[model samples]
Target: MMNVTRGRTPFLLVFLACTGLLAYAYYAQFQLGLEPCPLCILQRLGFMLMGLFALLGAIHGPKAWGRWVYGVPILLGAGWGMTTGARHVWLQNLPADQVPDCGPGMYFMLEYDFPLMDILREAFTGAGECAEVDWSFLGLSMPMWTLIWYVGLAVFILWALVVNSRGSRPLEQ
Candidate 1:
């Protein structure tokens, strides 16, 4: 039993570290004058809530009912992320003028190597439009990757729930 308990510690550590790194990224954007888009904001909220749930579950020590407690947050976060990703995908298909200006200039994407001419182009680009599905890395759009992330999180959380449930079973069973 103690060995099982000790094993959980590493899981908890990774969870905290991942969540903390994401939080720091969000904080950096805000501090560096890079406003987050609507999807980014929503994802951040989900991550924060997930972090809280994990923190609570760690403190509670994974009792039977505590499985339910931790499980809910991860599921909720996944739903939130899914919605954001869908919205982003929709925006990528809309006409230029119809897109929503979720935030300020494209400077938030300075890391993208947008040239002076490109900046001028985006000055006319409007907010997030359906026409511009330009952002991609590893051949996946930001929204597409976010969708994968949310689904992956959901799977992992469910796995944790299952593991915790099995651990609580009686030896006779």
Candidate 2:
């Protein structure tokens, strides 16, 4: 309906913005010389998945049943991003002595070090490198900012999806 179509615009804008952020993250790594640890990589995956779901939902602009279907993936992706971002923040706040020892780089884990499931487990649990606070803005570290962004996006998308799905029904008398 008209409501779903119009609502899709925000989804498109938000998804595109997420893509831009991911682009900046890569730029920070490759151009600015900031190294991404395994947990950072996991967070990146979450963003990518979230963007993918958002793109699909925006394009489909599905009615009722399909709308709910699209919402599930979007919500799941946001939840994933929130979880990873929170984990990263937790690792960053740990005392130096409490930080876990560094694991092999992501390359080794994928190519030789661990099985797929183990690699994911290691990435989420975070090795020593995940605790480094090499980047900050306005006193908040990158992970803190990432967590904030994920929370905001999750809330907005959820609200938008609910409103759109309900359409413009009249109140019961």
Candidate 3:
């Protein structure tokens, strides 16, 4: 039991980290008045997915093969976020004239009953609004920071997996 609990530490940490990030995102949106663009919303979803998987993994605390099951989804979530972040960063770096024209807000598109594919296409294509670097820390934009976090979290999970692979001894009765 102790060994199992010990193995869950990493998952719990990941979950907590995700929670903090999400909370800060909300703070940025409401308090800081930084509206999230379409790509930002998608990035948030990815973080949510990763956090959900990490929470489940911690609660389950399964040994051996079970780790792989949870780890895969977490990695997928991270990859999803990383890809979105990369796209956002690329958009931000584009020359002024090259930036795509701003599109309708996600809410507006949904309210108007736009096709799902169309919504996705517009979001991925990245509007002029998405290219603006409104928020930054230490010279890195929000998307750049998100990309760094995704990569860092993925690496942490991978390290945890490797460490857990070394079989633990069963507790004595």
Query: Best candidate per TM-score, number?
Result: 3
Query: Which candidate number would show the highest lDDT if scored against the true structure?
Result: 3
In terms of lDDT, model 1 sits at 0.61
User: CA lDDT of each candidate?
Assistant: 0.61, 0.79, 0.89
Candidate ranking (TM-score, best to worst): 3, 2, 1
Each model's total of backbone clashes: 3, 0, 0
- 1 or 3, greater by TM-score: 3
Q: What lDDT tens digits, residue by residue, belong to model 1 across residues 30-140?
A: 675545453555566666666677677677666665666776876787787777666666777677677766434554645577676655444334446423554566987
RMSD of every prediction: 9.1, 3.3, 3.8
lDDT by residue (78-138, candidate 3, tens digit) is: 9999999999999999999999998999889989999999988998985668899999999
lDDT of 2 by residue, 1-173 (tens): 33323447756866886898799899999999999888788888778887888898788877766766766776787788889888899999998999887877787887785888888777766477899999999999888888888888778777776776677553467
TM-score of 3: 0.90
